[model samples]
Target chain A: MKTIKNGIFNENPTFVLMLGLCPTLAVTNTFEGAYVMGLCVLTVLLITNFIVSIIKKLIPENVKIPVYILLITTAVTALDLLLKQYVPALHETLGIYLPLIAVNCIVLGRALSVASVSSVGKSLLDAIGIGLGFTLSLSLLGLFREVLGANTITVMDGISSFTGYHAVFQVFPENSIIPMTIFQKPAGAFLTLGLFLAFFNYIKEKRGAAK
Target chain B: MSLFQLFITSMLTENIVLTKFLGICPFIGTSKKESGAIGMGISVTVVIVLSSIITYLLYNYVLVPTNTTYLKTLLFVLVIASTVQLLERIIKHHFKQLDHLLGIFLPLIATNCAVLGTTLLNVNNGYSFIEMIVFSLGSGLGFALVIYIFSTIRERMEFANIPKCFKGAPIALITASIMALVFSRFF
Candidate 1:
């Protein structure tokens, strides 16, 4: 429980640790994209953490980093293939960012920091905690970007073709206000992230002062 | 695409950091000091170019013929990790001064996505060997250029008044947002 809380709040990957900024900024342009990316990372994190923990002792100290990289790359490749075969549309939307998961520092960082040093059960817990934290952060960032930038919330448009249940909520009428188009651009990603970081820091300082 | 055109396109138009966001970790991490940023940039360039060439050859010769192209990501990462290690040793042995300059950052280059990203992009785009070289070199130079400029800006930012909440990383990111807006003009 403490481990989970630590990951989700104390050491939030996006706000606090700031480990995987690339995917956080790049894919948050749309809610669906961000959601899927977050889930994918969560899944990969869980699997890699479990595997790395189990085999941590066997991996030679000198070659552990490459070994971890190989493990992560393999897991990401498997996930990529599965996504391509099952979720072709979402897969297309993800594009290279999906494969880039193999290099995402969050996954490797956990593999090195927690998984490699801890017991298998503890590592699994850490993975779940961090995964959920990452998902929350990515989804939050995505929600803000999509809502403000496009004036709509995208939940499940691409998946609707196969599932037959559309899920998009329009916040306002189209053309009502001049959309701040920058929120959808690369610049918007940085700005949104910066503001969020600042807000988190302010809250932390306030809590510290009160304590 | 022509060599010069590809060079310019990768360097400024499709910047690895500002546009693609491949290597932001080191971009912000090492950009606090201009001297450190230059060292990182040059090291990244050398690593990217060397890794790209090696990965390209391995892909065309070993992976393609053996029908194991699926292992590109794993193999490319291994190549990069080893390349960084080898480069470190060679620099330490040959250029003692340069080795001292890039001591800690040498190993960190292994994780910088730009190295692997460039190699993967080169293969995905199906560039020839020479074109791959130019693209990788251009991307490295571009990364270095942007980091150098950003470091200078950050140095000046030290004197400027910033809010307490937006002191360190947040301000840098906001600055990057503006820089990204400016870079978008190249498009």
Candidate 2:
């Protein structure tokens, strides 16, 4: 129960703190993409946390950063290889982002910030909490992006010719609707993240005002 | 496809802030005053260009040569982090007012996606050393240009009758979306 609460809400990665936006925006064009990323990050987070926890006492303070980097790199590389071997399609679509999990911060942030303090059991729970939180956030953001950008939702694919089809949530004939071009590019990545940040703040403010 | 096109394209077509969306955190967060924005821009510009060269050297000279491309991400991050730390000290001792304004943001540059984004972009794009510097400078200038504009809007926004919900980041983001849309005209 506590584990569930941790991932879904309290330590929510995307909405709460805005960690790891590079891959969040880049890979999250579809639900399946988000799921793959989420799973990958989840695996990295869980493994890194447990290992970091076990080795916490041995690591010297000065070299902590390097230690963390090596740990994340190893895990991400291993994950990269495994994913490529098993889920070659997701591996291709994810591309740079999959390797970029090394810098995602959520993995290291959770590992350093939480795993160091808690017991191994607690760290495992925290990993799930944060891992799931990050996953959920990535997908939700992807949901917004996929719906608005392409008006599509796709699940899984192993072939190049396969198509993704999703009904338009907000129907406006293509001619009438002014499709935002920035949303499709890096600028759009910033624009969307900023808007979502604003949305989170607005909700926080509104709830605060009511109280 | 040619070298000059890469230079021109990075500078104008995919200008980092206005186009590539790298470095928007500092673009929006540090750009409260025009003068300060300029200082921050120059500081960031210098750091980015240097970091690019350094990371490139390290990648080519050390990591790649050693078959440590696996460590490229970590090594790149370490180089930038330590470099920024050193630069922060130099700035604090050398410039007084500049330090106070840009000081808060100097360290933040370490984590800025733009910093990592450029490093990642350079390697990913397989840019030559000259091309990397050009891209870095263009990215910096684009960042400076947009921050200057965004700051002007924010200063004006302070006086405008903004809605309660849209008061801070909300309105700012909405404005940026439009501004991004506006910048898209160049492409």
Candidate 3:
């Protein structure tokens, strides 16, 4: 429980650690892309952590970093092909980012810091915690970008052949200037993340003061 | 597209950092110091140019011939990581002054998304050898250009009053957003 909370709130990958900013910013233009990206990271994180734990003793010291990277690349490659087959649109949306996950510092950072040293079960727990934290942060950022930039909330828009494909909701009336189109652009991504980071810092200060 | 147009587009209009959102980690982390930004920028440019050449050859000659293109991501990253390591040693032994500037950043460049991202883009775009060289050179210089500009702004920002909560990364990010806005107009 503490591990999960630590991952989600304390060492949140996006807001706190500030690792993996590439995907966090690039894909958050839409809620769905960000959400899927988070889940993909979570999956890769879990797989890498699991295998690293099991093979920790067998690996040599000098070759550890490259070995860990190889493991991560393999996992990301498998996930990439699967996404390409099952969800072509989401795969297209993610584009280069899906493969870029292999290099995302958060995954390699955890593999070095926690997974390589901890027990298998503990590493798995940490993975879940950190993964959830990452997912939550990405989702929140995505939600903010989608709502403010486009004034819409999209959830599982076209995962299947269901009737009326999009589950999108309009937040503002048509032609309302309240929705800033800039939020969907790269600048908006930076601005939104900055505000979110600042908000988190303010909260942390307040809590520190209370303590 | 012509080589000159490709160069311009890669360097400015489709900047690797400002527009494509690659290498944000180093862009924010290393940009606080101007010298560090230059060091990182130059090192990244060298690595990007070198790795793009090797990866392009491997992709066309090796991966395509063998029908194992799926291995490009894994292979490209490995090639990049090894290339950075090799480049560091050569620089250390041969170019002392150059190494002093880029030594520290060389290791970091291996994991930089920008390096891998550019290599992948080259293959994905199917650029010819000369086009690949031009594109990578332009992209690297573009990265250097943006980081240098950002470092100068951040240098001045040292004196600017900022909220306590927004003192560090937040304010820099906001500043970058503004910079990004300005750069986006070039297209």
Candidate 4:
């Protein structure tokens, strides 16, 4: 329980650790893409952490980094293949980032920091914590970007041919200045993340003061 | 696409850092100081350009011939890791001063998405050998240019009165946001 809360709040991957910013910023233009990307990372993290913890003793001290890289790459490749086969649209949206997950610091970092040193159960819990933290941050950023940039919250989009996209909530009028279209672009990604970070920092500091 | 156009597109219009969001870790990590930024830029260019050539050749000659393109993510990362290690050694032996500046960032480059991302993009775009060289080199220069400018801006930002919560990464990101906004006009 503490581990989960720590991951979600105290050591949130995106807002706190700031690892894996590439996918965090790139796919976050839409809510669905961001969360999907987050889940993919979460899956990879869980796999790598579990495997690393299990085989920690077998891996030699000298060659651990390469071994970890190979492990992560294999997991990401498998995930990529699965996504390509089952959800081609999400795969298309993720593009290079799907493969790029192999290099995502969070996976390797967890393997190196947590899994390599800890018990299997502990490592898995840590993975869950970090993965959830990552997903939460990505989803928050995605929700903000989609709502402010496009003025529509995409509940489901390109998941399948039948349902299609449904923009659930309309916050501002279509032609109003309230919804800044710039939020949809690359620049908006940075700005939104920056502001979000500042907001989180403010909350953290406030809590610290109370303590 | 023509060589000049490709160069411009990679460097400015679709920058690896500001636009593509690749290498944001280092972009934020190393840009705290101007000198560190320069060191990181040069080191990244050396690695990206060198690894680009090797990965391109390996992909076409080896991976394609063997029908094992699926191993690209694994193989390319190994190649990049080796390149960074090799470059670190060479710099240490021949150019001690340069090594001092770049020594810390060298290991980090192996995991930098820009190096791997640019290599994968080259293959994805199906660029010829010359085009691959131009694109990777341009991307490296673009990474260097943006980081240098950002470092300078950040150096000045030290004097500015910033909010308590928005001191470090937040402000830098916001600044990059503005930079991205400007760079988007290139399109």
Top candidate, metric lDDT: 3
Q: How well does candidate 2 match the true structure in TM-score terms?
A: 0.81
Per residue, candidate 2 scores C-alpha lDDT tens digits across B1-187 of: 7767766666656666655546655665676677777777777776788788899888888887788776666677777778889889998999888787778768767666677678877887788887788788777767767787888888888899976756665576667767766666635
> Over the true interface residues, superposed, what is the Cα RMSD of model 1?
1.0
Off by over 4 Å in 4: A161-173
Restricting to chain A, the TM-score for each candidate equals 0.96, 0.85, 0.96, 0.94
lDDT string for model 1 (B1-187, tens) is 7999999999987888888888999988989999999999999999999999999999999999999988888888889989999999999899999987887788998978888888989998999989999999999999999999999999999999998999999999999999998887533
Q: Model 2 captures what fraction of native contacts?
A: 0.36
Per-residue error for A79 in candidate 1, Å, reads 0.4
Kindly indicate the candidate among 3 and 4 with the higher TM-score: 3
Comparing 1 with 3 on TM-score, the higher-scoring candidate is 3
- lDDT, model 1, position B130: 92
Query: How high a TM-score does candidate 4 get?
Result: 0.96
* C-alpha lDDT (0 to 100) for residue A21 of candidate 2: 57
lDDT of 4 by residue, A11-93 (tens): 89999999999999999998889888988999999999999999999989999999999999999999998888877877888
**CAPRI category for model 4:** high
DockQ of 1: 0.75
Question: What docking class should model 3 receive?
Answer: high
Residue pairs in candidate 4 whose N, alpha carbon or C atoms collide under 3 angstroms: none
Ranking according to TM-score, highest score first: 3, 4, 1, 2
C-alpha positional error of residue A120 in candidate 1 after TM-score superposition, expressed in Å: 1.8
DockQ (C-alpha) of model 3? 0.90
**Which model, 1 or 4, shows the larger lDDT?**
4
**Residue A68 in candidate 4 has what lDDT?**
97
Candidate 2 off by > 4 Å: A84-92, A158-211, B1-4, B24-28, B32-36, B92-101, B185-187
Model 3 lDDT, residue A51, Cα? 100
